[model samples]
Target: MNGHALELGGIEKRFGKQTILKGIDIEARPGEFIALVGPSGCGKSTLLRIVAGLESPDAGRIRSGDRELGELPAAKRDVAMVFQSYALYPHLTAAQNIAVPLVMRRLSGWQRLPLIGRWLTPRATRDEIHARVRQVAEQLEIAHLLDRKPAKMSGGQRQRVALARAMVRDPRVFLMDEPLSNLDANLRVHTRSEIVALQRRTGVTTLYVTHDQAEALSMADRVAVMIQGCLLQLDTPQRIYQDPRHLEVARFIGTPRINQLDARVDDEGVAWVDGTALARCAEPPRDRKVVLAIRPPALHLVAEHHPRGLTAWVKRCEYLGTECLLHLELESDATPLIASLTPELGTAYRPDQRVWVAAEPSQTLIFARSGERLTAAEPRLERSANQPEKLDV
Candidate 1:
């Protein structure tokens, strides 16, 4: 534990003409878990790599605790990276893999000798190394699999080995770049909990990068949503979901994303989607259209002509075990909007069923055409969802 455990100030990176990380800035306190989330190729992994000293930033300073890592090599930074591919040496057994970091740091080049240095060097440090390896293996529940090589272990097991290797170093910060990507869906869920538990036990400040919104939302203390080389929103998981700063953040966080209804702000500062007034919002620019983002579960089916209800055309409906999803092809666009409905209520729904969808005035978000979100603007309609800028995904 230390002050400003990790910080990246004005970080910028470019690959040729393509700018990957544009002035990225973030901080992780001791014991903090900050997730870096984004769409594929949005520079999330690149940012993590830059922080790990694996990739150099064209600009900006990377710091871990009190030391500046600008001139330091990866080994000198005391930062450990648990890679997406596991990156375990297939020839080495699990124990050997976990011992690699300790071996590199503690043993002199010749001290790694098979017979000479092993018998001649000090024994106290070698015993400490064994104890440290055992501690991490026990923590990760890989003690039984210590002798198995990467080729014999499952993806989840391999992931644990990678984590244990990083753990043995007891670094100031742990940088994990999509460490769960290779596991099966069920295994991913299981491993995620394990990772969270391990982080708690070790109290290591972590920067976890992933493209999966659910992974970030469930695991992170705060999530930073990146897009096109910029971080659009960073907030608690619940805040990111309920109040998004940008339309792109709103569209990226949820299971089915959010349903956007085409609407225009009238002179009276009211927004009317299709033929119904969704909310009373301040008049946006005359020619620009506002997108009303409503969470699927936020709206309910109401009686036709009911106050604040929306008329939607149901295109397809899917029945999941506990809930059903209503896919409606809005008249505004070709993309079919999805709404998650509970099975208890989905009993009344059907394909091609015309339904009235509506939410409270405070449940919808209005956005400008360019994805710039306007939250404080006076609402013009009765059902507008007024929100503060946030990112949940």
Candidate 2:
């Protein structure tokens, strides 16, 4: 089946006094996988429902290819939705469940009549549907479970059945809303790869909605982050993590959360944190306060006597096998800072141990007071003649 590009223009939705989606716009290229992710009540699922024609938007238009989807009923939209619940029929076997859509579409009402419908239905039609069902089941590796009912299947097995049902339709677009949320942690990870492979093999344009950021980052070609009824950022996972357009995006995309420290830009356009020079800004200095955001991995711990580093007291250390996270409080301002350390280096420090921390100047991000990102052209290092020499480690 050939995929078609899908577009949403200025979509808006509201219920009573509460607004859910606020003039959101997005597009998915043909055969591309886009993930919509956000916290609870952020309208990620609502947006997916709107695209599937399951919910009406207060404003805006949905278009697939050159066809306008306005006023199109859910059945006529030609989009297949795999709901979060799997929504499989408990009484029907997997094969029969996957054949439901075909039975409704290919058989006439009179041919669908209980026992007599089997006699009335054409032999060729029944054979065709059975073949199609088996083909999809095989693709999902659920051919052996086709005769089993929903109650006899595991969560992952049932999920595969639902996907087979949707795939059998050969729709222009696929909408999946948290299809992996019901599975266990290991199963969820396994199923994520399966779903991505299935989508690619079928060349289907898909939109996946989930509250799990890791799933979105790992599975999608592009990710859209929604918060408070707004589409905060939409970009590749790498760009979204490395260079977030807004402070909210930066804080939401990373683990251990991005560190926010109060800082000042001096007359020489130098950004200082706890009296330690961090980076030189390209923007003209106004002696105004700004918020500096640094990821935990970008900050490194150093000896307490390092002159260019900020002296801090280690508050705690969390060892996670692969790495350690050190929580420290700056002595100059008492602000909290977190540094991701190697397992070896982290084991040497204990709580209340005095140390110094410095950030990688190139990796630091500066945000205005209003939460907008401040672009830096060049960042120069600051040094003092009388202070102890700086240490690279």
Best by lDDT: 2
Tell me each candidate's TM-score.
Answer: 0.92, 0.93
lDDT of 1 at 31: 85
Let me know the TM-score candidate 2 reaches against the reference structure: 0.93
Residues 1-393, model 1: lDDT tens digits: 432477888889999999998998887777889999999999999998888888999999987777899778887888889999999999999999999899888999889887887876579988888889998999888999999999999888999999999999778888999999988999899889888988887788899999999999999999999998999898999999998999999999998778887776666666666556777655465554788888988877789877666666887778887888888765444446777889877756777777876787688888888887766454444433553122111
Off by over 4 Å in 2: 284-287, 305-308, 381-393
Highest-scoring model, TM-score? 2
- The Cα error of candidate 1 at residue 301, in Å, is 0.9
Q: Each model's C-alpha lDDT? A: 0.83, 0.87
How far residue 88's Cα lies from its native spot in candidate 2, in Å, is 1.4
